[model samples]
Target: MITEDNDPRKGKRPDPRLGSGEAPDLGGFTMEDGTVTFDWTQTRVRLARLADAGPVELGRRRRFFVARDDLAGVKLEFVPPLVQAIPSTCQSLDEYLNWLPEGLGRHLIVLIQAGASALGLWEEDRLVAHKAIKKYVVRGHGKAQPTYLRSKGKSRYGSRLRLRNARSLLVETSEKIHEWRNESGPFSRVFYSCPVRIWSGFLDGKPAPPLSKEDLVKIPLDVARPCFDELLRVRRRSLVGRVRTLGDEER
Candidate 1:
């Protein structure tokens, strides 16, 4: 069902906060129309005592187990709102829309993986950085080739896009459609990467980091098929501290 032609971003669109701090220079990116803008505030939700500003739900939501069998959790829920998230070193594009929230100045065209939350960022008075998004891997790539049109004509270089379903019109395929006509790969996406950090403490605040089938043996795990482990029955907390930045320059 892949259809979004020309897609040089089809007409383009991005940047959203929804208030007044500024948001318009878009073909360059600097958005922050403001509705809840503190520019995604950044990690604070630990209040079981820090005087408690909110978000300390942590235990007692019950009925979720594994070695005992109860299961059933991920239908979606958890939409408190506020987001504008891009962070993998941010090479440029105007220092990543001046760090977004208004600077999404390139006419705001997100989805090279959240280009760091521009769509008005979750209006309600921004400052979102409540934290807990760990291990993000946004990723991006779209050089066509996954086609399905086969035919369409109009002329004058406008409408005539064909490539529809070629499962056997020949033979050899699927190296991601031979790297989408391989000029050396990635014909459209250009390039992208993600880290998106902000995680401070999880498994309790419930921001979705619970997987454990033994945490799938440390990392590269991808065997989905109803393997919904639910972090092996939830109870594993103890992060609360970690900063790392200097390019994650650890030792």
Candidate 2:
């Protein structure tokens, strides 16, 4: 059994093949019942991390992973780009999306700033992993805050950036740095276009209860809709009020 300190991919369900893909598999797991379970692999672990943070059990062995990455593993930061714009080397938004992995951020940065970058884990080279990471606004509706306040909003709504529902793994491992580098040009401008910091979390590659489609569909929208609706109302109300007040407030 590989310890967490030594093997970065330790406990990850290894595929019965090479990273390039081949056979005999690299990792396996053994159950308490002494039963043998095969066909389990690491690629699954990568996909699992994207959704949930936990160790996955591969084939049959004492195989398992520590659930959830430790705090030190996650790092978060913002970086603006050297150029005023991002060059996707492609034409349309769909072409860009099609060119990369899921959960990307071009549309997001375009709305927030001229350019930005995001760094996280990759499953078979996708922006997927154990600890989630991404960018968002300080308020539920604006760009990331210059500074986080005490979050005076109702306790029901804790922090605004968190509300965007983006999280990043902070672990400064080779993998973490690798992901950041891919997004460096657009993720930030802090380090000559490198990331100043990034949100990170330990990824033990352990498997946990899988998130069901029902759970994914209902939970977030239910939690976020209230505040989103309120922010929209606040903006509209402020806009209309500005029209009425400009004529008289000057006096």
Candidate 3:
């Protein structure tokens, strides 16, 4: 329910250094042209101070806003109460387009989470192609056990299984990245955001890594949900390791 009218710039000066990136000239902190901007550093600190601070609720998304003050300082605000701020997940190319800023053209956006991931290609704010994948779960439920009798076997096994799956998923994700480049058309730029650990272990690796230090954009995990959901809608097509492009019949 937050709106532009609540922008702090009208009344007070924002923190000048709030969102300056490693290289100030980069557009990461720019708020020009109605572009919705997010600053993970200041946002995280302020979020931790909120009384309701904790993990985001199930099936919801969170957003942090950064506004420019009249003096050029930066103002930061998040959707209040964080728990009920789910803006609804993007389900179609049009829906996803609505969430992005105007003037984006031929850019690749990839998002990865612990259990799911998504990749999409957009040109002039129109979705050209996309791919999404959902990791399968083998076990269903678990029962409480006494701490003295607790076993690490099940946890270790699950970790190993997930690691194996993650390795395979990494390869598939890399393939899609290449396809977006060589097959779809030459994307002007690529923006991929994910957790540091996930990015390092899988994406920042040898023989066709998905991202480089210069291109990775660090973002909150909550922001990753919609990307995951956007891809989830196309999981069926991606299962066959093919890129889903415009006008293609649904499988």
| Higher-ranked by lDDT: 1 or 2 | 2
What TM-score should be assigned to candidate 1? Answer: 0.17
Model 1: per-residue Cα lDDT at residue 172: 18
The TM-score that candidate 3 achieves is: 0.44
Ten residues in sequence with the least summed lDDT for candidate 3: 236-245
TM for every model, in the order presented, reads 0.17, 0.18, 0.44
- What is the C-alpha local distance difference test score of each model? 0.20, 0.25, 0.42
Per-residue C-alpha lDDT of model 1 across residues 172-225, encoded as one tens digit per residue: 112222322332322211111111221111122222322222211111112121
User: lDDT: which candidate is best?
Assistant: 3
Q: Which pairs of residues have clashing backbones in candidate 3?
A: 105-124, 106-123
Ranking by TM-score: 3, 2, 1
Candidate 3 or 2, higher TM-score: 3
lDDT score, residue 21, model 3? 26
| Candidate 2 structure quality by residue, lDDT tens digits, 58-142 | 1112112222233334211111111111123435323322433322222111001111223222233122322213344345555
The per-prediction CA RMSD against the true structure, in angstroms, equals 21.2, 24.0, 18.4
